[model samples]
Target: MQRRIIIAGGGTGGHIFPAIAIANALKKIDPETEILFVGARGKMEMEKVPQAGYKIEGLEIAGFNRSNMFKNLLLPFKLLKSLGQARRIINEFKPQAVVGVGGYASFPILRKAQGKGIPTLIQEQNSFAGKANMVLGKKAKKICTGYDGMEKFFPADKIVVTGNPVRGNITQSSVTREEAAQHFGLQRGKTTVFAVGGSLGAKAINEALHPLLASFVEKDIQLIWQTGKPYFETAKTAAAAYASHVKVFEFINLMDFAYKAADVVISRAGALAIAELCVVKKPVIFVPYPFAAEDHQTFNAQSLVNKKAAILIKNDDAAAQLGTTLFSLVQNKALMEQLEENIGKLGNTNADMVIAKQVMALIG
Candidate 1:
């Protein structure tokens, strides 16, 4: 008999990519395994999941609006409608297990699955668990975590520290520095710095680096910058003066090359970003998005800073401190090498497989 499973959630690349990684791992483990993805309608996963060659069903759901209470008036109705839709999908798919990867669609599908006495797994990808995951964790058969000490959030007995699954391209990258440099239209011998601020772009990171483009050129340093969409024009205009040394992108499709080309990285401390950084083994200075739920991004960065594996800059201080910090770190070869070695020790390249096997265990 073919085993069927439903994986749910996704809003950002953080949630969507890891969810796809798990689905891929499951297929690799059993070619006969049937998988269906459930995501919030109009979310990124609806498009990205299909691009990855998987079938997905979208729920008419939206997350709670934290900024404007007026926008949340229809939230309850949306949730109820989504729950009904989730039940129909579950009844038709008849999945042996359901996995929630954290996002708006996750709650309805997993809640409906648990109500039906179906085995469900929760993959909590943060140092601090969200309200939805914490509530669902009560009935979950297993809670897979990306960070240690998640017992504070979920049932300790059901928790398994599986580390977050990173995209395969990064974990198995064979891109050399020369190839990466050529791909980005930069030179191999120059010091290269890569900055990424998630998929939406970071205002602090962009503002901090804007005035420093000339300094980068003067120092003969090369920068490959992913400005997201909003910051693309501004970043492009700023880099126009130093086109030879700076490459600006709205969204980088080939991150494996970016990682290989970089000597040091400046990034936001999101869980998936941290997971990929661990695999790439680059010396990283993390500027945690201060607005993250429970300020979890800060906790994520501090975890590595405590291990001497990475550096942290508060979002508020990025404008005043980022350039100086980057310059000093680039000059310190020993510290860079030390950070790279310690961070590499934290990478778990097989997390997708481990989580897949656990899901299969639930099926048995």
Candidate 2:
């Protein structure tokens, strides 16, 4: 019988990328293996998964509405509807194993798999284990994590310290400094700062960057700013005067190349973003999003700071302190080198391969 796997969940890059990484790894081990992706109907994975050359099915699912409780009054109904949908999907797919990447769709799919006595796996990307994953891990065959100390929530014997799988192009990119500078339309001789608000974008980060554009250029720093869709027009107007040294974009499709061009990076501390940063081994200043679930992003950045691998600037202090903080980082070559070295030590370029190998062991 052909080995079939169900890959479920994804609402963000942190979840989607790892799911894709595992899929690719599994295929490399057994080209004839069967795989299917299940994601929230309107989420990004529906588009991205197919583009990566995989089949996908959508489940009408939504997570809890933290901003508006009234919107979630119908959540119990949605949950019931999704579980019924997931059962039908699983019955047809007949997967031997199911992997959950921890999004809204994951719980129903994995819970169904567990009920059927099929093996289930979870890849938790955050420092704080999500409630859904915590519940799933209680009976999961394996729990792969990016950080340590997760035994408190998971079965220690079943846990594996498989660092988050970063995209290969980013983790193994070979673009040289000059090549990446050209890719960003930046001058070859200037120090470049990379700024990104992540996929959905951070409003506070965009606002903070607007007022600091002139001073940033005055210090001879070039910027690669990802202004996100909402702030593109506003951020473009703000950076119009400093176009010579600043490249403001609504979104950056070629991030590996951008990483190569950056002397310093300023970003929101999303799990996948942090994983990719560690791979590139750049000197970075992380500004964690304040409203994140349980403030997990801050915990992600603090780990790096504690290890002298990166600097953490609170979201509130971004405007008042980011410019000076970056200026100090750029001038101090020793600190920059130290951060690169310390962070480079944490890069797990082979994580996808290792986890893939383990997945094969389960099938055998």
What total of clashing residue pairs does each candidate reach?
0, 0
Off by over 4 Å in 2: none
In model 2, what is the error at residue 130, expressed in angstroms? 0.1
TM-score of each candidate structure, all chains considered together: 0.99, 0.98
Q: Provide the overall lDDT of each model, using Cα atoms, as 2-decimal numbers.
A: 0.95, 0.89
Give the best candidate by TM-score: 1
What are the per-residue Cα lDDT tens digits for candidate 1 across 235-308? 99989999989999999989999999999999999999999999989999999999887898999999999999
Cα error, candidate 2, residue 77 (Å) = 0.7
The weakest ten consecutive residues by lDDT in model 1 span 62-71
Clashing pairs in 2: none
Q: What digit string (tens of lDDT, one per residue) describes model 2 on residues 224-270?
A: 99988999999888889999988999988889998989988999998
Q: Candidate 1 overall Cα lDDT vs. reference? A: 0.95
User: How does residue 265 of candidate 1 score in lDDT?
Assistant: 97
Candidate achieving the largest lDDT: 1
